[model samples]
Target: MVEDPHALFDAWLHEAEAGEPNDPNAVALATADAAGRPSVRMVLLKGHDERGFVFYTNRESRKGEELAANRHASLLFHWKSLRRQVRIEGPVSPVSDAESDAYFASRSRASQLGAVASDQSRPLDSRETFEERYAAADARFPDVVPRPAHWGGYRVSPERIEFWEDRPGRLHHRRLFVAEGDGWREGMLYP
Candidate 1:
């Protein structure tokens, strides 16, 4: 058995990345706003380590504000080609400022500009308006654009992680790891 749940998670993710045709790193991120209403959207997993799973977004965006108000979040990683999935729930925290800067620098110039231009989850008058905003940002920063102060990464330190693998006859294999006081407890469940 993998001593750490994260090790197992890495192995499974690697397999999914190799076998899936597209967007293998995509996951559904779920967050709840101040009113306790939940929202979910597909976001790319940029990095993962012992600290937890990492993703980036605008600090003022809907998900960002939700996470700020309620530090709890969950993620679902589905690989339909392999009929497997992984779910993680945890407390969210902003990744180190240095980490965020490095990742931001690695993004394409156009994407960096797009991030600066987008008021994610906010109403936009039209696609043209959005494109015009992007154009303006591009013009404003004709060189290497600095990462927006309001954009960065968050790390979700999971307290629970579950893995599901499909089997024949509608049966399935399910394993879960729940964080205890210091470590984690692993158990299997009925499919």
Candidate 2:
């Protein structure tokens, strides 16, 4: 077994991607604003490594604003197909512009346009208003759309992670790794 839980997580994620029938990279990200009010919603996992987990969003969005105010965050991945789940809590930071640009360029043309068109987490009058802006964006950038300044990515460097698996009895298996001052401390938990 790999000594580092982060490395083990990467391995498990890879396995889940291969084994799961759908949205293997989907994760529920949780963040709190300055007021300590928490919010969570599902987002796709863009990248992961020793540094952290990466996901993209509009800088002006509520989640983005919250992350900016407080860099702490948590994440959860539930794989029903494998009856397994992983939870992570960590510090958040913006990804490099180069990274954001690369990911934005890889997205579909319409998605690129939508990123520019939508004022994410902002109030809108109607669907017509939204579609009108979307159409305008499409017309404005008929080719080679540039990534919006407001759109980018965030990476969470985990301080703790928990892995859970279902067992025959009600006693599910649970393992957790906590970040110590310079390294990680691992332990098992009763389910």
- My TM-score estimates for the predictions, one after another, are 0.96, 0.95
Which candidate comes out best when scored by TM-score?
Answer: 1
Candidate 1 local lDDT, residue 111: 91
Clashes of each: 0, 0
- In the predicted model 2, the residue pairs found to clash are none
Q: What is each predicted model's overall lDDT from 0 to 1?
A: 0.93, 0.93
lDDT, candidate 1, 2-50, per-residue tens: 3688899899889988999999999999999988999999999999987
Reference-based TM-score, model 1:
0.96
